[model samples]
Target: MLATPIYIICSPCPQVGKTLIARLVCEFLLLKNGTAASFDVSLKEPSLLDYLPHITETADVIDTYGKMQLMDPLIFHDRVAKVIDLGFHAFDEFFKMCEEIGFMKETVRRYVTPIILFVAGSDRSSWRSYEMLQRQIPPGALVIIHNEFALRGGLPEAMVGEHVIRIPALPAFLKFYVDRLSFSFTGYLRDEKDWSTELHQWIRRNYTMIRDLELRVMGRQSYKPTAPCGRPRWHER
Candidate 1:
């Protein structure tokens, strides 16, 4: 049997579209593969059960730190794909817990793949966060995803490696809509047309990159993440 793929989607800061992208990826995988599932490790806000009603009924609701004790080893046995959405605030604590329980080391040793999706807009602070995260993530385990917000200042290509995937700036109008109705079904329908087009294009461009990373990790290919460059002296204004 093929081992399940677990995707950990996180960022160095909050509101970087971590959950949004995770949901979209989960939906895409569900459509393609029947056994895929997604879960949220956020200790606050609406729980995963609140959003994904399909699996909430039977799926176990383990706390962020409780997963180590609650989850069965066989849970990783199936062809199922799990996406863990970790809120920024709980990220460090969760990592520590993973270490305490030995899950962290096991995850790195096993087929579990870690991919950091960094989101930054025109805000210089966002870029700073991206750079900080780039430096912190373990080598060969990070993939940068730039979320362009159509702002005046764009990030330079040199800052990122070849594995970086650039998502075109989402229109301001679309962002407004997304912010207004992100968690509602109406949001899904209202934005479906535009989002589908944009998302499809984005996925097409980055699919190979994502797939390659997955293959590389799954096949146990030797890989090393590049060390981040020194911090930018000046923040973009």
Candidate 2:
């Protein structure tokens, strides 16, 4: 059987669409299965939690108490799939604590898989960050995300991880629609008014990508997560 998935969306840079990816993944899992929990570590702007208020909680890991609030629930609340929209500011601290406490190992031991989606930028630092991240993490635990909005130049060759995911550029005309406070793809799908619209089509495409990526996270095709110290070669479709 596949292990429970804990999706952690993060990046070394800010405004790289990490929250958007997290929201889409959480929504996709909810549709495929039943329930999932999410964390918003955005100290500056917890917009993801605001968008998905129903399933998300705000977590600040700058202090010990804040760390406990986030880490405790993620470890003990094994009842549903977990997702963390990790902020760029808290990136170092979050991963550092995880490493010191063996967060990934402990989760895997409890039958939970840790999936990190590291969003990339066009700068040299992004590539360096990606390489550093790959070294610190197990192979199957990381996926490189290429967000076209920021990195129109595409990801550096060195930034490629075991698996690569692309978040296509959102159409300029539809940007305002999605940025609205009430705009949610999951909520829109539940309403009958969007059946024949372009927004619906865009969401469907996102869903397809999320599902395929999810298969890999769940140990399918080229991506297979094994026991401790063993990580399969995760690849993109």
Candidate 3:
């Protein structure tokens, strides 16, 4: 029995708060489950390392030479919960690497436990990128988190497709804190306050939706079917 790994893939559109949302979600899950871990595949930036030290210790850096390697699947089985941060600028290269290594589909299916959190925003470009990603990702394997201004109209159900989960705009105060911290630490300004109290309230209101999305992606079983007569069925028939 092993716990599934959660993959947070930040879509193209810049400044969409993908990394921040990923960090907050990881923090929330860690606090709730007490056994979760977070990882960052951005070797160049290593943004999540400062926040979550435990998972960083085991992270594998992907550099320009195109070297991408992941930890053994068995190691992550049931021992830990993982949140992966995919950098915006590195999306194409990272995806190419995943394809080259055959890790995208193979690893996902082998682990039998994985989630793809695609973060998006309200702007036209961001929403467009979301639409594109939705089509590219595997069915029942995508979770959409919409990040918008607190007073904005929020997300539309039709835009993100059926399996989407909208995380409303972040509170003003939390957004300020995140912006300041991101600037001070990484020289990168990322505003992701939608994970604040106000946003959490929204998430709570829609908790069932989130749970259902998780179930669809990570709740898959590794068991195989046997003969109809209740007898052992061999693959080599």
Best by TM-score: 2
Q: Best candidate, lDDT-wise? A: 2
lDDT (10s digit) by residue, model 3, range 1-237: 454666555765566667666666665565456666666655444377666666553344356332323434322346466677776666666555544554444444445455667666556655665666555566666676666652156564446345555555656775675554333211121233455545444544444454566556666645343233221111112
How many residue pairs clash in each candidate at the backbone level? 2, 1, 4
Across residues 1-237, which tens digit of lDDT does each residue of candidate 1 receive? 244566666654665566555655565556457556666666545444456657432222336425532234313435677766666665555544444545433444443444555544444555565565555556555566665553235555435453555656566765555444235433354456765575445444444555666676556534344344232211110
lDDT of 3: 0.54
lDDT for model 2, please: 0.76
| Superposition error at 67 for model 1 (Å) | 4.5
Displacement of the residue 122 alpha carbon in candidate 3, Å: 6.0
User: Predictions ranked by lDDT, top down?
Assistant: 2, 3, 1
State residue 98's C-alpha deviation in candidate 1, in Å.
3.1
Whole-model Cα lDDT per candidate? 0.52, 0.76, 0.54
Give the candidate order by descending TM-score. Answer: 2, 3, 1
- TM-score against native, each model: 0.61, 0.84, 0.65
- Please state the error at residue 100 of candidate 3 in Å: 3.0
User: What is the per-residue lDDT of model 2 for residues 1-237, given as tens digits with 9 covering 90 to 100?
Assistant: 446778898887877878878888888888888888988889655478888899988898787778877876676525588999988888888888887777765675556677788888777767877787777777767888887866787578886545777777777777667777678787887884757787787788889977777676676423345445422111110
17 in model 2: Cα distance from truth in Å? 1.1
